[model samples]
Target: MSVSIDISGLSHERIHVVPSPLAELGMALHALSEPGHHPGLQGWATAVSTRLDPCLADRLCEADFLWRSTFSDVFAPFAGLPGQSTLPGATLAEELDQLDKLTDEQFVDAALEFTCQSTYSEPDRNLLADPAVQRRALDLAAARGPQQVKFTQRLLDEPPVVRAWLRKLLEDCDEAFFADTWARLSHQLAADARLKTDLLRRKGLAEALKALSGAVSLDESEQLITVDKITTGRTTTGSGGLVLVPTSLGWPHVMVLHRKGWQACITYPISAPGLTAPPTVEQLTRRMAALAHPVRMRLCRHLARGSYTTSELADAHGMTAPEISRHLSVLKKADLITTRRRGRYVQHQLDISVVSRLGSDFIEGVLR
Candidate 1:
């Protein structure tokens, strides 16, 4: 349910938020390969999925080996990839070809080693020699899928199987969907990077990191940071400072990849207008329920012109102040509006972005 990162000794200067086209590509491939599993992506990823290689998609769905650090983390950083900004295929091919030199042993060892370690730390050399650790490694492999289990076994036995298959999957992913995905993300990625850099210069590292996502935060005490996750797992020590990457592809949820001869990174959703995550079922229902009420609709119409106080809204809508306050409470809880206190009076303002996103999601969700 959480990954608590202790940052007591780390300097603020070391925590960074940057963009990486390569990591974005890796996440997109996995997400596009399995869109139905991610509710936030299901609406828009349909069009993108139609362009993907079906066979490659199927293979990735069954291959956990591809996700193990040997592959994803090992290949995550392509320092120049983000700067390419276009020609995703050309850039991807260039990076993959360069990484092709990673020996079958090197890649397989990293992959196999990842399953045994508790964190992103280096692999134990004698892991295979210990029966208990070996069993855990096998159990982890089998949990993925039959094909992945086989891939893991083959990699352990031959190690060379890693070379051709991994490269092929990476390349096919590019040929299928990387270009279109990059085009969708290019402008936002550049803008996000610039904004974070500016924030760092104007405010500080603390401000810059805090601005990255609601899911991530550096505590005021600065000794610890908390990351929300689906299931609870053991906390890992920070080997290196954080590398914050902003992207549109990783919607709804954020992902953490620890540093292993590379930067420890968190690739988060881009804080942009067009690519907001689909609201949760509760959120959708709440907002819908708010609109369904005639009284709330009247309130919304009045607030659309400008912000209003509880008393003002009641005055405009011909309702008791207490009754108007109740309606305003519901609308604010649904995230359709925001309340800002100004001395004695609080102003209720419509969240215009939420209005646009609501319309877009309603249309897309209904049609989908």
Candidate 2:
């Protein structure tokens, strides 16, 4: 279903575009755990598998349908944006303890909502006579039955322990791969945040918001928004504010979620050239090689002064237009410069973030 939201009077300035190491790590774990479903992620699967705890995979639930429900237990979309996520400061145990605060009814209600319930009607004969309580148990079982029966039964038997088990699984799986993956993906995340921040400064919130997705558009005439992959009246699509999150894990995917008391959000995937698989330090090698050419280096300097037309750069540097064109193409490939055609004239401007490494951590030892 399409989501139609009226943002005319809402505060667009409340938008936040940021990255989350934890959420991305969650996606990574999910991807690697179910590699058969994602051929494109085989490279990441290979890299992550080398360090994973074999036993953790068993607990992670191989059934795609079941796993997503289980995943939400640990990484639910709360009302607030990730900036307010408990994951930042809480250890896995502490996070599990937060789950402890959830009443059994609340947990069951959430788990049941995630899956199909058409087939089942009541809990097992032993647990409770209350038809409502019986349905909760049976619904959990039925939801996971097609893909896996045992995992759901585990949830029923040890309702309170489900979160604890998830905590350990996340710990095991994340410990194996998160640091390196984060190191590789953080550059893209930071660059995204910086880019959006700059866009907001230069273009205002409307343009910046629209730039987020091909399927999403803002209709200023009616102050309405039609966003893709989101149904109307869900979470916080058009309530009053939004949070924009960028992640490498989300590169091929976009997710929208809303919860009361939390920032309604949409997360989109982002990509970095030559660094799609991970270890984006290779991007450093690519960028450095791009700057190695004297003409390209000169082009970067001239553009840094301000955006320029190819012919203008050619005359300033005493080069042929064709030669300047070739240099610009190379710099563009390196992401050091960006170009947009203004009428018949192409304008080239420096992408300063790359010059500053997008304010990400330096490759400590990769480039000598």
Candidate 3:
């Protein structure tokens, strides 16, 4: 599944690289919620976890429905909230001020849109008014957890309260740690934006898009930029064009927002120096050991060509399914491979980028 962006009429001027404090804050909250998922930011997340005020932490836990959503639209820039700015640069203060200005109706709509559980259905503005749809949504949220159930209920029954609670939660987050976190990340984020802008200027759109991340690719013939994502959809740049926002906390996840009434934007991860720690000796040794086996080396070579199921790999290697599974597990543990579900089967593919970086990583580890 992938998001194919139609960029046929997109001009160089339409491509933007901006830093968003709002997006960063949302990602940071997500990282906080799932610290184990973001190993790169674990140290920083742990430190922040320690500093969080107990009340503020509890408030964030209540809003798990926001960050846990596939697309956290509430934090998305230009989400059509009243008084929200669509410009390239806006400080965290400015963004929060805009959030503060959201009417009860606007806030409820945005929250509902984010919390919508349907895969094929569009979010209804009058969803709360429809008893049947509201009950279905509530039931889905209830299955997830009590927090989501309470959040959905608040969004349905108490729009004003939900709006105020969200605003205060964000304000409290800034006061607790996001203020300092953004300060530390702002300079690096600005530098990454400038570098991307330069890449766009010199190499043009195709190369710039290709350089964005391994997950992004440009098909010149199709006039499309495809983002490897779990959700599949196609959207045009329209007259609003596309905005590329660089975020540090949003590592390992690239979010594409192409919702109606909002400018299309892609929030991608940017490397922030001195923030993420380098691989420790144990990590490097693990990677080396995973590749040391002759069978695993052959497996990597085969996976480089295309994704294969465990049985397919076993057949190719003249090995049993259990044997192939053990080798795959080692590679997976070392982050040398990735897996995706395809119907009833699971396909494993090589993480070529990580493998490509091994030599440099080894040299850096040695020098350090």
Number of the predicted model whose TM-score against the real structure is largest: 3
- Candidate 2: misplaced stretches above 4 Å? 4-9, 36-38, 62-130, 133-137, 140-143, 146-150, 153-159, 230-240, 259-262, 272-368
lDDT of 2 by residue, 75-141 (tens): 4433233343332212333444555555554454444433433111232323322566555556545
Q: Which residues of candidate 3, in runs, are more than 4 Å off? A: 69-71, 81-85, 100-106, 109-125, 272-368
- For candidate 2, the per-residue lDDT at 106 reads 44
lDDT tens digits, residue span 1-368, model 3: 57777877778887788888888888888888755435678789889989887887887877765774344666864545432226543777777666656555545556654333423235444565778877877775554456667788878898867777777888789889999999999999999989999999998878877777888888988888898864567777766567888988877678787655556778888763232334666788899999999889888866754466787678667799999999999999998898987455687878755665577678889887
lDDT of each: 0.60, 0.56, 0.73
In candidate 1, which residue ranges exceed 4 Å CA deviation?
6-15, 53-58, 61-72, 75-90, 93-106, 109-132, 220-222, 230-241, 259-262, 271-368
Clashes of each: 2, 8, 0
Cα lDDT tens digits for candidate 1, 1-368: 45556656666566666666566676675555444224466555687767556687677665633542222554553321222121212256665654554544345545563342333444443343455655556666553345656766666665555667777776776667776777777778878878897897799766776787776776757566677653233233344555667777665446665433334566777743244657766677789888899888777755643455676566555689999988888998899987776445577866655664676677666766
Q: Which of 1 and 3 is the better model by lDDT?
A: 3
Summing lDDT over every window of 10 consecutive residues in candidate 1, give the lowest-scoring window.
79-88
